[model samples]
Target: MESPPSVEIISSSFIKPKFISEEANKPVYLSPWDLAMMSTHYIQKGLLYALPKTQDFSITAFLDDLKHSLSDTLTHFYPLAARLSTVKQQNPPSFTMFIDPNNSPGARFIHSSVNLTIAGILTPTDVPITVQSFFDHHKAISHDGTKLSLLSVQVTELIDGIFIGCSVNHMVADGSSFWHFFNSWSEVFRSGTITRPPVTKRWVPPGPDPIITLPFASGDEVIERPNYPLGLRVRIFHFSSDSLAKLKAKVNSECNTSKISTLQALAALVWRCMTRARRLLPEQETTCGMAADNRKRLSPPLPETYFGTSLHSVKATTTAGKLLHHSNAWAAWRLHQSVVNHDDKVVQEFVNSWLEKPLVYTMSRYFDASCVHIGSSPRFDMYGNKFNLGNGLAVLSGYANKFDGKVTVYPGRESGGSMDLEICMLSKNMKAFESDEEFMSVVTY
Candidate 1:
């Protein structure tokens, strides 16, 4: 086995917004949806780009440009450059995210270099464990927002490429907002401006009270620091557009339903395959949860630029026997129904229930060996984030919030309907899944 690359940190500093206004300094109230994510891990993701061919390429100049663009970008997305404040002395403990211009709580900017090539990191079947080092705040959860920076960016220079890793508090932003900020940063880097300015005003669901407070007396009571599991393997599986279309066609034809989407079909396929690989008892129950964006599901749908955490986990469950005995179309139909049923009414009910009693998303609440939870979306324009460098070679997730059944979906670098599944599972189950003929047949990796 090859030795892991050594990463040396050259500098660690905070990048504040270039400018701030009175309106920008106002405290942003946390909604029930935001509070629910307090215990979850930060969203750690990054882009890898090959180095430019010019001989005059200067690392110092490139780093300077990145910092300046980030500072300018934070002017619009000011919340990211701020900190989460908690007041335990209040009646119910007031929790709000505030930007203190005097304190200037800026986002952490880290510059580092690795002694390895990009191929050394990407060519392997399993993502190198060291890749997690490319990100910051590995031990910090969203609840730590009271003191920690809400967002952290680490730029690690490679032998012939660079990796820009970003870690954002999950309570402050979901995958949509994470990518929105990333795309905006890249736009600022290339043109010194953004085409679609972010809508920083958070959306509040209709309820008796717009601001919801948690039942806890202090933020520390809700903080959870769970040790990451061991003996888990992570691998990326590529499914080409043709393969995806064929899978979708097969399932739709079998069920005589044209409403099953490619993503639904793919999720069903993974759920069934993982169940089979686990060799669970026939009578045992299995669940598949997919993160659904609620922006469009509301009555007065939120704007595309509505920037905050708006994701709800829509789940489908069935007996292991039924999932395996039934055809792929059957499973796909189940998943399709779960997503379809999560409409405006269901979204409202969820928000109301959450408002009545706010609950933080601890690891135990959502993860299990018998369940598979899918996060992120393939619809994100990942490859389009070209910060003067050419298009990205790959997109990767970090070690935070990952477990045996976590699966993250990303658009393939080629980007014509191709999809990549970053799957994490127990070593034994991963071995079985790799050997499964049906699953391997469609995997282009």
Candidate 2:
């Protein structure tokens, strides 16, 4: 493997929101959903942009514009400038947690650069870039509870373009809220105005506090990152529109249903292929934990711009051999059914079912060796954001999802039906997976 590139940080400062409502200046409690992620890793979402190639580039001006616009953008996203705090009521016990807006510390704004260029990071041939480079190296964001700011922004200037990255507290929001903030940032920077005013109304699930009862790890408990069955690897694959159409057709025809969705087909294909590559025994059970957006599904639909988490994490299970040896359509049908069944009521039930357990929903407990965790989704229109700085945003590298046996799906760079699939797994499994004939048939690596 090649050595990681070097990056330099020139300056750093906190960017405060230009305006704050009187109500937003107080402490905001974490809903049951927010409590579920208290002990987990923060979600780091990175955007790689190929800025409009300019013969003359002004670093000073660029930094000023970015910082100024970001400050303005924060006006509508005041919670991001807030800090996390734990409340204590007694000795052997705990108290409800809340976001202390009164103690809000402005978000960190970093201006950095790397020796490399956009072309060097994204190749015309194989994998453009590994997200670990952004998450692990040149790290400017910290998620530790010690950090006062719940959000951080790092803008790296490459030779030809720029890389815009944001680190956000998962406790404050999920993937939906994460992107919503970014889209708003881009809009403000490009046009000096926010097209979508952020909605801060958090979804308070109908449940008691300390959402999940599963036993959370004690402060001393240590869970090492997964690196077994040979070291791990992360790779990105592009699936063209034609390929998705083919899978959709294959699934629809075999299942005798015309409503089979693209996501269902893709999920089934990846799950089956991964299980086959692992060569699990017939009786060995494998599972998939997927994140579902429960926004519109709620009885009183969540506002399109509701700026909080509405993710209802759900799972599906079956024996390894059954998933692989069974008809592709069968697996696809199962996946489709699983999602279809997880309606609004099921979303609430998912939360209610977990209210009795300790907060075991930490990242360490999210996925096991036998299960694959699928987060991120094609539904997020990532490329739609016009990062006014570029020669038309060329490619979106991706967010950093460090865990093994994980997959994140983003909108394809090409047509509407396409997809950019990022798969992270053991190195041995990746090699076996890359060689899998069925998987490679429709994928462009």
Best candidate, TM-score: 1
lDDT per residue for candidate 1 within 1-445, as digits (tens), equals 7668778999999999998878777878776778888888889999999998899988899999999999999999998998887644467554544333345459999999998888888898999898888999986788887788999999999999999999999888999999999999999999999888888787777567655666767766766775578898999999999999999999999999899999999999899999999999999999999999998998899888878899899999999999999988899999999999999999989887887777778887667789999889999989989988898988987879888888999998888899999999999899998898888888888
Worst lDDT 10-window in candidate 1: 94-103
For each candidate in turn, the TM-score is 0.97, 0.89
lDDT of each residue in 394-430, candidate 2, tens digit only: 4343333455678888878765788887787777677
Per model, how many backbone clashes are there? 0, 9
The candidate scoring highest on lDDT is 1
- Displacement of residue 298 (Cα, Å) in model 1 is 0.8
lDDT of each: 0.87, 0.71
Error of 2 at 386 (Å): 2.6
